[model samples]
Target: MSRIGKKPVALPSGVEAKIDGQTVEVKGPKGVRSFTATDDVTLAVEDGALSVTPRGKSKRARQQWGMTRTMVANLVTGVTDGFKKELEINGVGYRAAMEGKNIKLSLGLSHDVVFQVPDGVTVTAPKNTQLIVEGIDEQQVGQVAANIRAWRKPEPYKGKGIKYVDEYIFRKEGKKK
Candidate 1:
């Protein structure tokens, strides 16, 4: 019934997957990632591909079937290709710089905002206004970018703040004199 759940996840070359009870661990050149599935779904490897199936005819089982399959697919992709997020700072005085293992942001604030880099994720500032976040975990990379953007969201009037590379800010007209 679930189209996505019916498709098995293929293991590319140079990647290995191991199933331990309800947990699936995938190791690749980039890194190793693991995901545990709930009891509502069953995990198995058939003909070099990982598959997930519902345990019963219940609704929860069917839901887990698709969700677990996607989770396993993400693990494979994460270990093989990793994830990346880019941020752009737009403003007259707003800028970002790498300070050793931390990121120093000046978003027109009185003091520089120092963001400490956490383990398993790398933050780099290629230019004063450009930032790149890389990690094996997709969720972590996105969360880091969001936290950075939250510091100085792009304004509607001036569009001065940090935002994603492909994001667009809606402009607003100024008040009449």
Candidate 2:
């Protein structure tokens, strides 16, 4: 038996959940989100909570059982509190600014890098060296942050680049004179 799949995902206050076949939809104060599970798993809503179970004892069924449960839980959390990712720019002459719906980044490059914000997600630049990404879907928010960080990843030597607020950069020793 799957330990994670055994526990039901409780519906918090002001949050509603519904299950139609293998699809689970959740609505909350923030927004609404839905997820479709594989055929190896079964979905149901009961006792003010959502639950997932494997249709068979096979390996794939067991895998789907846990994954489906977690997906449903994520849907509930996304609809309720949503997700957020923060990035910090650390480099000389490196900064970020918002232009309409796009973000302009200056990572010590000759030309400024323009990143267009995607739909269902919001990007904000509170400071020239800080960025905040928010969205109802956790995956989208994370992916957007990753894409932004890819433009200027932190260097081990000087630790000068873009990175997550809570991330740590491993430094390397300089060559001997």
Candidate 3:
């Protein structure tokens, strides 16, 4: 049994959830978002709340059920509030700077890489090494942050690269000589 899946997602004030067949739509003060539940997943709304359940107990079904439910809940919450992700750049000469809607990053590479930030997604780097990504959609915020981090993952040796805030970098000992 999934712990988060069991709880009914509470709809915030002025937030509304509507189910039309497999599609579930959420509207809130922030914005609106919708998702369609798959065959293994089912969605239900009651008393200003939403709940998702699986049709079977199989592993695949359970996964689909949990993922869909979580996505739906996230949509509701995101529409009501918002989401944010923080990233930190490590390593000498590795820093980030923003230019208009595009962010320029220097990860000790031959040249700087420029990444375009999508609309509704905001990025800020108070310090050259610290980054903050904010948006209404959690997935987009996370994906963009991950893509930026992928430019230079923290290496095990020097642990220098881009990484999320509070993320631990596991160091690996050098091979025996």
Tell me each candidate's RMSD, in Å, in order.
0.9, 0.8, 2.6
List, residue by residue over 43-98, the lDDT tens digit for candidate 1. Answer: 99888899998999999999999899988898888888888999999999899988
Cα misplacement distance, residue 6 of candidate 1 (Å): 1.3
Alpha carbon lDDT at 171, candidate 1: 99
Tens digits of per-residue lDDT for model 3, 19-126: 999999888888888888888877888887898888889888788877887888899878877898999998989999999889999988899999999887899989
Candidates sorted on lDDT, descending = 2, 1, 3
Task: Encode model 2's per-residue lDDT on 59-101: one tens digit a residue.
Answer: 9999988888888889988988899999999988999999999
lDDT of each: 0.92, 0.93, 0.88
Model 3 ranges off by over 4 Å: 1-4, 55-63, 172-177
Among all candidates shown, the one with the greatest TM-score: 2
lDDT of 1 at 51: 91
Task: State in Å the error of residue 107, model 2.
Answer: 0.7
| Poorest 10 consecutive residues by lDDT, candidate 1 | 71-80
